[model samples]
Target: MNTGRVVLITGTSSGIGLAAAVQAAQAGYTVVATMRDTTRSDALLKAAAEAGVTVDVRRLDVTDPESVAACVTAVADSYGRLDALVNNAGRANTFATIETCDLATYREVIEVNFLGVVAVTRAGLPHLRAAGGRIVTVGSTRGLIGQPFNEGYSAAKFAVEGFMESLAPTAAGMGVRVVMVEPGPVFETAFGANSGLTRESLLTEAGPYRRVLEPYLDWVARGAHPGAQTGREIAEHIVTALTDPEPPFRVLTSDWAREYTAIKYTDPEGGRVRAMTASWLAREED
Candidate 1:
């Protein structure tokens, strides 16, 4: 968790991945920054150089299982061990309705966000167990509650959280840890633009789903933006988790995130959530 620790991070080209890698390097971790194309990671490389740390930049498309396996193998071979794996590579889908959106759109989102973590974590397990390290997966507040226009993205994150909740207990037994970093909408990143590549029709004419679409995007734009923590601020939180005397199982980014998690747990089940989102099912009401 500190400097000299060997950490591997996915999607280091921009946004949270970029910020986290820089901060982790500054914290003294020998960072391995992976992207779809390392040749284009010029900015991230420059940032690390400026910070006086050398990051092992490599090309790793997480969606490709072969790439994931190879990169992780390279990590183990070069470092002899890995202390942490940060699965911060993900994209959002801002469609008007699931009906109109093609299956390809949903697949694209899930492949990169959900399955990518599974692939990478599975590959990194042996090295991590040998080092008794940690796994940090980036999640969203959207994973907690169904937002309006971004169902696909939310679903993907929801799946990730579910997977980690199960994986954490097993990891703890082995002296390894699994932690989820849940952040609210932070304006510092370029998620929307990159998401546009996979999911289009987000800001189009209000469809039948206009009610859900407008309010959610507005809330995301206005409410979340003003209180959006700096990329550096979020980075520091990770540093705390890595070095804490007793790090939390999950680190929530905002007061709202904490309150919402409290509500979900305090309710015995997600009763409040299902009741509010009437269309959603109360399949696991406790």
Candidate 2:
């Protein structure tokens, strides 16, 4: 039990972040569970209570620099050290082609998904360095292989992937480990609902892209595939990455995720990935 070890997690109002907070506390780490609004923290608190674990719930808006800095500072001041940081706060983009997406929409996704990670990590690095800590990010398979209509989200996650991959070796040299946990389709999460996209809405907005969007939506509604996981399942992977003696740089949540991402690793030329994703948007007659 890591009684004195402290870990800060963002976006704990629901889903993966909430699960991670509860599990981390159960693992005996002092968990600081944060969300944009403290008013939304009932779920996290209740879960922690039910599990007979205590979590220090705080308000942290990752997109705001002041909020990020203040939260990290407070945690360090109160705990004297930070052992780990989980970059889990993210916003999903609506299902739309790049051409159809407005610039503001793209910016919103980037702000919360990519830059939010940057701000929090930057603020926590000093304390983390002192503790020789770790940073675990919740990434998606979309970051490895872009989807047809999720350009904004995929782009943001891809930026995160590049930034973390480049920072890993240098961080390791500093006695800090950085890991990315990649999950495929996650079930029982607010992630999909937060996107604010529905079948009718997407079809109405598809306009010129309807021909392609239809098949894409059809493929999505076909129900869960082997690669789909629950919030708890992904959270388990996050906790394992945090606790493992020598975790890999990239941790895929399930066997299906490993196989799915293996396509990208093997296809350096990008042909196989393109073919596979394209099949999801294929026309009925094709």
Candidate 3:
């Protein structure tokens, strides 16, 4: 029962992207799983095998315009149509306050997280419009509520959320659906491992900010948030966002994530979220 639908996914080498590729393939979509380097695709291949499905692997570095265009072209040529696109390629930044974070780190995060989606979406638009397809981007809860040490990553996701919102109406008119899947903490993922980032590396000079940074770091060490979701759980929501006839414009990965983001709407002035974060930073040891 092949759906005859083709979906091109970015960053499929591991974690949520890999899980979505396998799930989409098992659900009968012709899955084009792409990563910056195909050399890291063993995990994806193995996952697909375990799921008793096959996915076409390709090289797609979202940060590179040439690579993005080539990958989209190759998927269109090889598959004849692209029915869906999952914009999931991203990089986590070193935990640092804006004052301490390097400009280069911010640039790198924005290039990959925000501009990468722009590039890939630009290339895939014609094909998607032709197929009346869906565009699902993997965003983060931090996009709605800023966190202590996630300034750069959150900024990129905030841009993504805004970009998608601006594009959705026009795309709907052109018969393309746009969606964003926002996830909270994900477990058993290597996203931050290779980012060449650590909290310690970010604090070269403790200065006066150490007081604020110390508690957040201590909280994180004691489990930042309990009951974090796994990559597979987030991927499931992404699959649903793609396949549902009337898919939601925003899909938060968990109940907690949804509740957390809802605070923004409850208080548009940013008072509630600000207060909550301040409370977290001010909490004393138990």
Candidate 4:
């Protein structure tokens, strides 16, 4: 039981964030579950109730520096200590090739998915260092192997990978443990729905890229992929990363995710990844 250890999590209105919050609280940590809008916290509250745990729900907009600072300050002031930080707040980009995606969309994706993590981490680091705490960021397989039509999202996640990987050692020097929990496709999350995209709409909007988009979407729509996991499953990994005394720098949520990302490490010339992801866009007959 973590007891009085206070852990702050961002984007807890739903999905991995909410699950992690409840699970962390269940595991006996003082969980501060935060989201941009507190009004959307009903689901999280319900989940916590069902889990026989309670969480401190708060409002935190990671994209806004003031919100980030204020939330962290309030947590510190209220608890007098912070034990961990879970960077789970992020948005999925609408499906579009780089050439087809507007610059504004690209910036928005980067801002929320990448810079938001940065802002929250920067604000929480001091408190975390004081308690010898942990920083667990929810990473994606798209970060390891870039997807065809998800240019903005993949780029942002890839940036997160680099940032966390580089900061892990430095944070460790300050008695802070940083870990990245990499999940492949996650089910029961707002990720897909939040994109506000459907197969028909994407197909119609794909323009010249429809041929490629069709196969990719088909691959995605083939029910659950081998590496796919539920948000609860991914949250379990996050909680482990938070509580494990000697957690690894990277936590792959599933065996499939481990095997999938392993390709990048072994492929020196990037040929294997290029060929594999390209296959996702190839018609079945091809």
Candidate 5:
């Protein structure tokens, strides 16, 4: 139990944000779980009830500046201090290549993922500075690589990574720490369901696949199940990031992803496969 620690998480209607809120409340934190609408958060309310933990459900639309500011004000005014903030309200836009993407989709993605983060972080900076707390932004491995299909999602995440890196020094000066959790594919969640993909780019009037690729859609649908990390695991990690003396600035949740990153780090892009090919020779040298 976290002994009534005060925290806030955006996008609490479902997926990672919902789970994180439940877990935090269970851990004895007084959580302010903000969805776009509180009246519609039946699942969250029911789950919280079952767990016997009380979490305040508020309304927050990250894309709207007024909504973002209001949520921050509500938290600070009501709680008098905020211990931590988990900016988990985000989306992934698949099948949107740069050459063919709708400008509207790109704007929506950047507004919510990049600008929304800035709005909320700036609003909370005062209280976070007072509490000397931590900030956790859910990033993606795609943020590191240039995946062709997820251009919009990748670009937004890349911007987030850059923004976080730039703010790290200033945040540290205020005794506020920032961490980015880079997770690989997860098993279950509303992510795929809520993923704002459309036929604009994937099914253009002209091009290779004049129709959207059904097979690719099928693969993505099956891959993003929520069981990969239960609502509890994310909560535990969030707690660790808040309290751990030497919390990782970047935590990659997948084992293979870690191994892959390690390989990429040790050997240049073209050198990893060859390095892995001769394990015995490397071992002999060691």
Candidate 6:
């Protein structure tokens, strides 16, 4: 048990962040769960109560530098030390090819998914180093291989993977663990709804790409891959990463995600993942 060790997690209003907070608290970690708005905290509070553990919920808009600095300052003032930080706040762009994606859309996703992690980590590094703590950021399988219409989101995650890979070695020198937990197509979360990237809203009006996008969206709508993990399962893997003495630099949360990402990284040719994913879309279209 990490009794009294403080862990600050972003995006705890729902999904993986909420579960991670509840689970970490139950495991004896003092949890600080922050979301953009506190009004959405009801579900997290309820889950903490049900788990018989307490979580300190606060408002933190990760995209805003002021909010990030103020939240970190408040945490430092209150707890004086932070043992771990879970950078889970992310924004996904609606489906669009690179050519069609607006610059503002790309910036929005990068602001939350990439820069947000950097901001939070920078603010928490001193305290984390003091405790030899961990930094776990929730990335995506898309970080390994880009999907056709997910350019903005995928690019942000890829940047996160690159940034963390660069920072991991330096963080190790400071006795701090920096890791990325990559998950694929998680279910039981309003991520699509919350991210403002629902398939219907994006693909229904795909225009020129409708022929290819519709099939992919239909397959997803039909739930072709039933092995998608729940938020709690992903959170459990995150907790393991946090507690393990020597955790991996990157954690693929599901067997499926691991297998698929392996195809991209293990193959030096770098064509296998593209071919395989393209086949899925082609088959669906057919």
Best by lDDT: 2
Instruction: Please give the range of 10 consecutive residues that has the lowest summed lDDT in model 6.
Output: 277-286
C-alpha RMSD by candidate, in order: 4.9, 1.0, 1.6, 1.1, 6.7, 1.7
Task: Kindly list the per-residue Cα lDDT of model 6 for residues 107-130, writing each as its tens digit.
Answer: 888888899989989988988999
Pairs with steric clashes in candidate 6? none
Model 5 C-alpha lDDT per residue in residues 1-286, reported as the tens digit of each score: 6575688888888877777888888777889999877886998888899988878999988888889888889888998899888888887665655556678879888888888888888888888999888888887776765444576887888999899989988998999999888776654567766764464535553265433344444444555333255445565666667667677788776675576456546666646545443331232224
Worst 10 residues of 5 by lDDT: 276-285
Residue-level lDDT of model 3, residues 1-286, one tens digit each, is 5799999999999888999999999888999999998999999998889989999999999999999999999899988999999999999756777787679978998999999999999999999999999899999988888887788888998999999999999999999999999899898778978687666754555456777877777777788676489999999999999889999899888888878888989997888889888766664853
TM-score of 2: 0.98
Rank by TM-score, descending? Answer: 2, 4, 3, 6, 1, 5
Q: What are the Cα lDDT values of the candidates?
A: 0.78, 0.93, 0.89, 0.92, 0.74, 0.86
Q: What is candidate 1's CA lDDT for residue 143?
A: 85
Model 4 lDDT tens row, 1-286: 6588999999998899999999999989999999999999999999999988899999999889999999999999999999999999998777998777789989999999999999999999999999999899998999988988989999999999999999999999999999999999898999778778898998898889999999998888886387778999999999899889999998988999989989999998999999998998999898
TM-score of each: 0.87, 0.98, 0.95, 0.97, 0.83, 0.94
**Runs in model 3 with CA error above 4 Å?**
203-207, 283-286
Residue pairs that clash (backbone atoms under 3 angstroms), model 4: none
Off by over 4 Å in 5: 196-206, 209-232, 263-286
Summing lDDT over every window of 10 consecutive residues in candidate 2, give the lowest-scoring window. 218-227
Model 1 spans with C-alpha error above 4 angstroms? 1-3, 197-206, 224-226, 268-286
Writing each residue's lDDT as its tens digit, candidate 1 over 1-286 gives 4555799998888878888889888888889999998777988888888987778899899899899999999988998889999898886664546875778878888898899999999999998999989998888877877765567888898999999999999988998888888887666676666655431245455456555555555544456444467666677777667666667888997786687666666776767876655432122231
What is the Cα root-mean-square deviation between model 3 and the actual structure? 1.6
Candidate 1 deviates by what RMSD? 4.9
